[model samples]
Target: MEDFFKGRDTGLVIDWTQMPTYNTIMAVAAGAGLIFMYMLGRALVRDRDFRAEGWALTAGVLGFILTATGLHMTLEWPFATYFPFDNIVFGEPSLAFGVLLLAASLFLWKRGDKIVAAEDRAAEAAATARPLGIFVLGMGLALFGIALAGLVFQLFAAPAEEPISGIVADYPMIEAIFMSLLFAFVGLGAALFPIALRGFSSTRPLSGTAKLVGVVWLVTGIIFLLFGAMNFFTHIGLIVNTMQ
Candidate 1:
């Protein structure tokens, strides 16, 4: 039994060829990003009724998906080979984001009625529930740090990895910069959440900062969704290239 188990440990037990797990991860993350946009927009609208429970529930579902996948990627280092650090870059942040979303969703579900708007709910929760707010803010800061690292460290141009590199063989630098910028965009949006939450919570009225957060999330959502969808095709190319 020990000999047999040792033989199995030396080889891959699971097949990844048919499963585009990385792409699925991005797709789920994109979905969560879009939900953030919707939630923010709904919060920003003056006369609209913010359905905190429904939206928080939806976001929680996506958060669970991200958390599961992110935790796996971080711990197992599934697809990353040439650059194992890449897993840390993507996985840790994803895990943190997922946890934040889950936490926020739970709080909103419980004390949602206390908040008049989505922004208010967050701000109110932060004001009342210090820990949750701080956690969200910490995640936002972590994302910002990631964005900074991507820029300062030039993570985009680190190495021409598989599918992404193959897809943008012609314009590698451009695509790399674009990808890095996406991180920056999303990070900026997240970083601003605390500011928006605090600013609007006090006045309990629509504020410019909140509007800015909405715009950022909306743009981030569109870009992330499109990028994630495009990866569906590129990931196939990766599989084919590897097979060849």
Candidate 2:
């Protein structure tokens, strides 16, 4: 077991100066993603009729915020070198938020039966509850799965032996597999956004701003999926080049 473990070597260092400008762009995009997710979550939760929907939206928003913040720090933080855990593992703040969101989501799921039973006594209540339930359930599952996977990858994945070369080399195949799974989960969440929006629109009379936000979420999710797919291709290209 000791032979399988290696001591950390600080000699090799990540050269942030050589990092591409696009990394900054990615950081900004991640920030925007958080803001947008938060806005959508707020809109979903503001109505009294959508309690489940609200909690679900809140969980999703919180999860995205955690993910985006983590990405931003990884990509754009200048002082990452000062903190030993900065890049060695996921950012502590982000991981906390992710875990919180997952807990809230699970809470909602466990209490769903009681809520559904109570709403079944009235026709209007049943009608509204059904759609909200569906949307909330879908969002909860997607967000919780994504967040848990990320947290596991960050906390338990082996660290690199050398600091400068980064952790990618420590467990390259595991990192690749984890990244692929993460992106696929994100894509799954994105794909469900429009469906949730449509369900919300059908069941409730959203304000003009809320409707616009829904549309933006729908469009942005599409764009995010496209960008993610491109990233996948780019990774594949890099792998091929490395092999050559």
Candidate 3:
């Protein structure tokens, strides 16, 4: 019993049962990254504030670094990136990469601050003052509606394997169905954004491809949160028993 407890603390051995708790960290990392990217992009494009956007992007890069490292460390290599997952260690290289990001961001920020003309700045300020609340709100509702439609489809159309089993299962069908659902929901959420924007009480909030980015992000975040939470507590009785 003592050995088992020690193993859990050290991460040398996994319970297999508590996978959900650890994956909560991944969901957070992904969610936070998505939101930050969209927010900073908005500020950069609308305000033309390079310094702020650069720093924000730098921090986001750091987050991805840490999150990717965690994933590699936890598994052999969950993602198929070129980061040499097998060799990623929390060592000098990681620190060096972070330093590099900081330097690049600072350089861009300084350059951006210096280049914009006064007239451009004035125009940007005017643009920022315009109300976008109604536009954003309508988009949010549409994304939710799309996500709900996904849940309804899942409930009625076809059966899916239990969450954990489907995740690590060898069966191709289970994995395929789940991945299909992921694409379905994400696509619907994105596609619905413009349609929702058109039907808004206001004429139009804004226009561009990036307009729907946040809607897709929020929908994805909710989906991950739901799956991670469900899997986490699936074996709650076992969790409590182990604690005792």
Candidate 4:
């Protein structure tokens, strides 16, 4: 029993059965967010004929699904017992790349020749407010770079632990770093959603669906902020608990 307890403490074993029902609820909520985004994307494409933005939104939705699923698995399953490395490849990178592509599409959509004249006028009018736009684009690029680097690191780096039945072990340091990066990117991406929503609201007269999308984006941004804060607090709590 002592050995089992020690293993749990050291992250050699994880017990998912102990998770509270609230955890499951949060997981479901996260999954719903992803699905909502996806459906919205499809609706936009079909109804509004906005193909580029629709694809971008679809990617963002998929990214959210991966992120939510990863979080759910991390909390609901054994961290060390299952294949942790798979989470990094499928969950982290997918979320990051998806968001990056989404952001890129948005950036281009806003600045492409089709809308360049309008965007330029908007830019000139809000020159000072435009810093946020630049920041969003920069953060999107950074996230893509980080995702690429993580993928490379996963490919060439030594396994953190021996594979069990073909499942690769999770490296604590790598997992921590990747999660941190992911959360950072998500937070920034969430911030951009509200900004884009506002832009859409101001410049173009959106139909009922677009209005709903803006509201959803705002709400999702708040949820992502909460999620990021929870992750940060959990990490801090872990460190403090370890010290004791």
Give candidate 1 regions above 4 Å deviation: 1-23, 37-41, 44-48, 116-133, 151-167, 201-205
Which segments of model 4 are wrong by more than 4 Å? 1-113, 118-204, 242-244
Which pairs of residues collide in model 1? none
> Superposing all C-alpha atoms, what RMSD in Å does each candidate have to the true structure?
6.7, 14.6, 12.2, 14.0
Please provide, for model 4 over 1-244, each residue's C-alpha lDDT reduced to its tens digit, 9 standing for 90 to 100.
Answer: 3432234344433232432212223333343444455344334333333334544455455445544555554444433344444444334433443444455446544643343344333333234334545654554455455556555555322222222211223444454454445534444544454355334432445445444544544454455446544544453443333322
Span of 10 residues, lowest total lDDT, candidate 4: 157-166
| Candidate lDDT values, in order | 0.61, 0.44, 0.42, 0.42
Using TM-score, rank the candidates from best to worst: 1, 3, 2, 4
Clash count (model 2, backbone only)? 3
Which prediction has the highest lDDT against the true structure? 1
CA shift of 134, model 2, Å: 25
Tens digits of per-residue lDDT, candidate 1, 1-244, equal 2321122333312233423257355554755555575564565344356667876787687788778878887888865544465677677767777776777678668867777544445455546544454665666677677666666665655122346555455554565577667766666766676666656543366578766877777777777777677667666654444441
Candidate closer to the true structure by TM-score (higher is better), 1 or 3: 1
Residue 11 local lDDT, model 3: 31
**Residue-pair clashes per candidate, as listed?**
0, 3, 0, 0
Candidate 3 similarity to native, TM-score: 0.39
TM-score of model 1 vs. true structure: 0.73
